[model samples]
Target: MEEKLTDRMCPNCNDYLFYMEYNTEIPYEGNITIKTYLCKSCYYKDVSIKRHDMEKPKILKLKIRNKNDLKTIIYRSPDASIKIPEIDAEISPGIASRGYITTVEGLITGIKEKLSLMDSHDAIYIEERINNILKKNSEEITLIIDDSSGKSKINSGRAEVIEK
Candidate 1:
């Protein structure tokens, strides 16, 4: 079932935001609830996934060897952390973090975009490294998603999951 509630004030802009929740059943994953909040005023948005029957936490790793690997799908939970050791960058889970579903290429592009908004000195080097990976000009890069909530996943056969 789906439930929707709107008019919630956005923390950033004090504007009305829309909130929606729904439950879905996956073949082997049982019941899961998804909640989404969106604010058109300040462009604030967040998505969260919760499993009715929670499972053990796990770490998912996918090595991007070539361009094909960049097409791999990734579903990242808000409670998960993303690390690209090759580029020396890590997106830690915190209040600022958000859940998202995107491809490996999209994830890398997002890193570049976020870094572009920052004023750090090392942002240039990190952006260059990200570009090399995106252009398929560098060695293999590993994308790691550490999810304590056990809700994040890389939808690819090449993805390795290590249970914690």
Candidate 2:
């Protein structure tokens, strides 16, 4: 139920968007979990988990056609300026290749992994893969998993984790 963003066109580059499917489960008291494409373009996997903290599951289902698209997802989090908590979103491109642990980019990477977000889309295009990992900051997982709480953090374009 988000805005049916099934179709999105990156203003910078016109690469068709394809959401890498994701299935997530958050824990009631433990860490959040996510299951997404390990190699989405090449290998797709079915993931599942049950946690008490995460009242329900949320799937981000993301796709990156080019560098511009990738950058948007990663930076958009902090730019929103809202502290995200206990999340279970999925993203493609499982690594961060952008910055170090002292810069804004670094915080983005840290937040992503903490949020339990996976950008592991099996990239079919070698060029895209290289760009995503090497040029687009694959080391960082922009999505985050805040402390487990009985609440939902998924919106049309954002997630809001809360306590019950």
Clashes of each: 0, 33
lDDT for position 160 in model 1: 96
For model 2 the TM-score comes to: 0.21
- Across residues 1-164, which tens digit of lDDT does each residue of candidate 2 receive? 12122254433444433334334532222443442323223333333333334343322322333344344323221112223121222322223321111333333345444434434443223334333543655643333423222232222243333332
Best by lDDT: 1
Model 1 per-residue lDDT tens digits across residues 88-163: 8789988757667899999889889999898888998888878887885587889999988788889899899999
- Lowest-sum lDDT 10-residue window in model 2: 77-86
- Each candidate's root-mean-square deviation in Å? 5.6, 18.4
Per-model TM-score on C-alpha atoms: 0.70, 0.21
Model 1 off-target regions past 4 Å? Answer: 1-51, 96-98
Candidate 1, position 121, lDDT: 80
lDDT of the candidates, in the order given: 0.84, 0.33
- Tell me how candidate 1 scores on lDDT: 0.84
Deviation of model 2 at 33, angstroms? 19
